[model samples]
Target: MGNKEQTFQKIIEIAYVMFAENGFEKTSLAMIATEVGISKPAIYYYFQSKDQLIAYIFDELYKEIQQDIAVDYKELTSANFKEKLLELGYKSIEAQGKDPYFNKIFNQYVLLAARDESYKSQLVELETSFLTSFVEVLQWGVRLGVLDDTPHIEAKAQMLALVYDNIGNFMLTGNQLNYRAIWKEAVHSVIQGGKDDK
Candidate 1:
């Protein structure tokens, strides 16, 4: 990367840590600049304000997490849909566990979204994208004649996404629950459309 791109990326990395450690309110541009060995104005050259920098951080983090857990949609089939979904769930948990600041940063963003429209909009878009992945997978299964095309696909996808989020939250908070089992059960239920075999 060029010097300017390197400096911009450095600023983002430093700012992310500071926000995760000190929070959005506590971390200032000056502090980030100091950590990055650049002038506060240098930060402005890349980001108009701390909020903008944080929004960028949120976008980048989301992309990284998505890439880490992404499944090959092109290769998806009915026989492997459940397995792929389980892998997605497990990989999501693994990715979150790999990043010590992920939960903290996510919580910070949640708090920011509570009062900031821009943050709220970005979060809504991110969540919509996540949900769309599940919906697309379900639709793909239906098209392949391997899974039922239930009318409640969207609702089911939403519930699955919620389960993943809660599982990550519980694990991060040291709740010590059987997350793998919980995740497997959740995936099974979604796949079965909440039916009871017995």
Candidate 2:
């Protein structure tokens, strides 16, 4: 867009790389400024502090996931439940690998917002909106007969948490596992539990 928007995006991109490489405690504003090729004061003009920048990064990412899901919902409304669930699972995992910085901010800052009373309300609203969108997909699946009707249509949220936690653990330790297989099993189990055995 404009120069201001471009600069803001540049800051985010630099922050993402720094956050991924150095983590929350190790990353510094000076490091970001250096990588961004901007003066320290210039950085401050856009983001007063590292904490503010980190929070903004997380907010953008959180909104992005919601936006992407909304787009997918519109295009995939006719797809069966299994297909929709698989798509969601794949996208979530794929995003973790592709946007590790976003993953880092999400696991660190976004989750921490829940612990702070000032941020807790907004965090809850964001979570509620995301869950609502996911549950709508589940309802669509049930209507399509691809998903067995089940109580607590909120399983998508739980599934996402499991996936994210597993990814975070892997990132922190370099441990690896068959995430796709594990996710498939979880989805199958949930779907099976909700369906008639007959």
- Number of the top lDDT candidate: 1
The local distance difference test score of model 1 is: 0.80
User: Model 2: runs farther than 4 Å from truth?
Assistant: 1-6, 23-26, 71-79, 110-115, 152-172, 192-198
Q: Write the per-residue lDDT of candidate 1 for residues 115-173, one digit (tens) a residue.
A: 98988998788778787777777777778775677898778878888898888788768
lDDT of 2 at 121: 73
Candidate 1 has its poorest 10 consecutive residues by lDDT at 189-198
Q: Model-by-model lDDT, in order?
A: 0.80, 0.68
| Shift of residue 75 alpha carbon in model 2, Å | 4.3
Q: Residue pairs in steric clash, candidate 2? A: none
Q: What is the TM-score of each candidate against the true structure?
A: 0.80, 0.73
RMSD of each: 3.9, 4.5
Which candidate should be chosen as best, given TM-score against the real structure? 1
| TM-score: model 2 vs. ground truth | 0.73
